[model samples]
Target: MPIITRFYGIIIKMYFNDHLPPHFHAIYGEYNGVFDINTLEMTEGDLPNRAVKLIREWAELHQNELMKIWEKKVFKKLDGLK
Candidate 1:
């Protein structure tokens, strides 16, 4: 997974092999959660209150770009491409 966003001890990311429904993972140390790009849904797990708020803001800020990336089904660079 690539570290797409970072703030408040949380690292938001996505895997090259992640499935559709357009989501990314928010990881805080040993904790993790899934956030949907479309509906802005916290699909799985969570973070502390302030962290969650920050993440929500981050997600919203990049909503359009995230969805654009997801919909295109593009991965930054796969292993063999190197």
Candidate 2:
């Protein structure tokens, strides 16, 4: 997995040549969740409430960039939420 961003100890990543629906993985400690870039819905696993909110906000802010990267099928590090 390649980390695209990190915020509040939440690590956001995506696997190269990953599956469909344009999603990313958010891992915090032992918890992990796969979130859709377009819908911002958790597809698998779970995270803490604070982590959830932060991830959602960050995803919303970077949705476009996320989509672009997904479309290109590339793994690049992204700036963390500020």
Candidate 3:
């Protein structure tokens, strides 16, 4: 897994050549979730409400970049939520 960003104790990552539907992983404390890049929906696992909110906001801000990285199968760090 490659870390895409980190902020407010939230760590965002994605796996190279990962499965379909284009998604990313978020880890905060002991909670973790796999979020769909397009819909911002948690496909697996669970996260706190605050963490989910932050992840959604951050994803909205960088959706395009995320897709680009996903399509290219290249990982790059992204700016986290402020």
Residue-by-residue lDDT tens digits, candidate 3, 1-82: 8899999999999998888999999999999999999899999977999999999999999999999999999878999998
User: In model 1, what are the clashing residue pairs, if there are any?
Assistant: none
Which residues of candidate 3, in runs, are more than 4 Å off? none
Top candidate (lDDT): 3
Instruction: Report lDDT (CA) for all predictions.
Output: 0.71, 0.88, 0.93
Q: What TM-score do all the candidates reach, one by one?
A: 0.77, 0.91, 0.96
- Candidate that would win on TM-score: 3
lDDT (10s digit) by residue, model 2, range 16-70:
6888988999999999999999999888886888888899999998999999888
Give the candidate order by descending lDDT: 3, 2, 1
Which ten residues in a row are the worst by lDDT in model 3?
37-46
Winner on TM-score (1 vs 2): 2
In candidate 2 the C-alpha lDDT for residue 14 amounts to 84
Ranking by TM-score: 3, 2, 1
* Tens-digit lDDT string for candidate 1 (1-82): 7767666677877766578788988887777788888877787985666666767778777888777667775644211100
Name model 2 segments beyond 4 Å from true. Answer: none
Each candidate: how many clashes?
A: 0, 0, 0
